[model samples]
Target: MSNVLNTFLDENLQDLRTQGLYNEIDPVEGANGPIIQVAGKQLINLSSNNYLGLATNDELKKIAQNTIETYGVGAGAVRTINGTLDLHVKLEQTLAKFKGTEAAISYQSGFNCNMAAISAVMDKNDAILSDALNHASIIDGCRLSKAKIIPFAHADMDDLRAKAKQATESGLYNKVMVITDGVFSMDGDIAKLPEIVEIAKEFDLITYVDDAHGSGVTGKGAGTVKHFGLQNEIDFQIGTLSKAIGVVGGYVAGKKNLIDWLKVRSRPFLFSTALPPGDVAAITRAVEIIMESTELHDKLWDNGDYLKKGLIELGFNIGDSETPITPCIIGDEKLTQQFSKRLIEEGVYAKSIVFPTVPKGTGRVRNMPTAAHTKEMLDDALAIYAKVGRELGVIQ
Candidate 1:
């Protein structure tokens, strides 16, 4: 390697280590469930995005196995070529019904879904008013569009309205769009979609919502857009099959014309290999499960509330989270990392999240309690938290 490249890597690596920002990944021994094994130690896992615990569901696993036997492992080619399989069609149809949209289109992953969908619609001739705390994928997508991005304070409806008025009335761009995450993942706060929709209507701005964290956790499992009954009002509804759906893929659900356009223009769909047939089949079934009943959804909320109440009672700062995601805020970076490390050592796998995932000095150990966590598990984890917190002087 070149000397300049080596120096750059070495300097940055040392800087991140000194600042406690370098994250060391731990490999889970088996399926990622309520109880996970890391380095041969059994731990109560609060770090997984498996909200409903469907990733390990027996029925979905069997379905995937059967489908793979029939369709083989890969999709063979890109969608525009010969990769579009019957399972893919079924998955999109199910997604459309699940999201309450006229049609839908699936992609390889949630991150690239935003990358493809945003740039496919908005361009240099347009401007987007994005929420300040939107996901990195959305931020990168906006940059890729070459559209003028104007950020509004996180969930500040008044600020969004003001920006919408300015961008739409300035007469500089051909179109204006407002985009936000349905639920802010870092703090777990639900976006003010109702207020945002009102502002979009006033300014005639196109509405886009990425409900990656809200689907199956809110709106009786439909999503945040449906949570507010704004399905008809919002133009674009984006979601991921990976998180709540417990599969691996992403999709955009909207009107038929939008779906039709994305099938042709979205670069990921046109270029990247399609999601595997078995995964597609399993994803279709997962959405059906979410739509059929709310048992898992209700249980997930119950677990979240139970864990949040326990953390708060023990004098931990879990920020204002409306969903099952609980973030234990620790302001100092080094202390936050220490808190997480101690928790892991004590047999609780709650990892630390710091800049640039979140702002500096606002480091947190984000917890995601799923439906699969029993009361006994939560009680055990809480006890461990109390011990760790006291030992670290984070609590009384």
Candidate 2:
């Protein structure tokens, strides 16, 4: 390696270590479930995005196995070539129905979905008004579009309205779009979509919502857009099959013309190999399961409320989370890392989240309470938290 590259790497590595911001990954021994085995230790898991416990659901596993046996492992080619299988078609149809859209298109992963969808629609001729705290994917996508990106304060509807008015009335761009995450994962706050929609209508701005964290958790499992009954009002409804759906892929659900355009113009769909047949089949069934009943959704909320209440009673700052995603805020970066490390040592697997995932001095241990967690498991985890918090002087 070149001396300059080596020096850059060494300096950055030492800087991260000194700041306690370098994250060391732990390998889970088996399936990621309510209880996970990490480094040969059994720990109650509060770090997984398996919101409905469908990642380990027996029925979905069986479906995947059976489909793989019939269709083989891979999708063979890109969708524009020969990779579009019957299962892929079925999955898109199911996603459209699930999202209450006229049509839908699937991609390899949620991150790629954003990269493809955003650039496909908005371009240098357009301007985008994005939420300040959106996921990194959205930020990158906006950058890729070459569109003028104007950021609004997180969930500040008045700020969004003002920006929309300025961008749309300026006549400097052909179009202006407003985009946000359906659920703010770090603090677990629901986006003010209803108010956003109202602003969009006033300024005739195109609306885009990435509900990666909200689908199958809110709106009776349909998503945040449906939760507000604004399916027709929003132009782009983006989601991930990996998180709440407990599978691996991403999709855009919207009107038929938008779906048609994405199919042709979205680079990921046109270039990347399609999602595997087995995964596609499993995703379809998972959507059906979520749509069929709200049993898992109700249980997930129950667990979230239980855990939040416990943490609040024990004097922890959980922020204002409206969904099952919870965060235990520890303002100091080193202390937050120490708290998470102690939790792992004490047999709880919640991980520390710090900059640049979140702003500096707002480090947190983000907890994801799923439908799979039992009361006993939550009680045990809460006890461990109390012990750790007291030991760290984070609580009385």
Q: Positional deviation of 387 in candidate 1, in angstroms?
A: 0.5
List the lowest-lDDT window of 10 residues for candidate 1: 316-325
Candidate 1 collision pairs: none
Give a tens-digit lDDT track for model 2, residues 1-396.
Answer: 999999999999899988989988999999999999999999999999999999999999999999999999999999989999988888999999999999999999999988999999999999999999999999999999999999999999989999899998999999999999999899999999999999999999999999999999999899999999999999999999999899899999999999999999989998889999989999999999999999999999999999999999999999898888999999899999999999999999999999999999999999999999999999999999999999999999
Candidate 1 regions with alpha-carbon error over 4 angstroms: none
For residues 1-396, what per-residue lDDT tens digits would candidate 1 score against the true structure?
999999999999999999999999999999999999999999999999999999999999999999999999999999989999999999999999999999999999999899999999999999999999999999999999999999999999889988899899899999999999999999999998889888988999999999999999999899999999999999999999999899899999999999999999999999999999889999999999999999999999999999999999999999888888999999899999999999999999999999999999999999999999999999999999999999999899
All candidates' TM-scores? 0.99, 0.99
- The all-Cα superposition gives candidate 1 an RMSD in Å to the true structure of 0.6
Error of 1 at 233 (Å): 0.7
Q: Rate the local accuracy (lDDT) of all candidates.
A: 0.95, 0.95
In candidate 2, stretches whose alpha carbon ends up further than 4 angstroms from where it belongs are: none
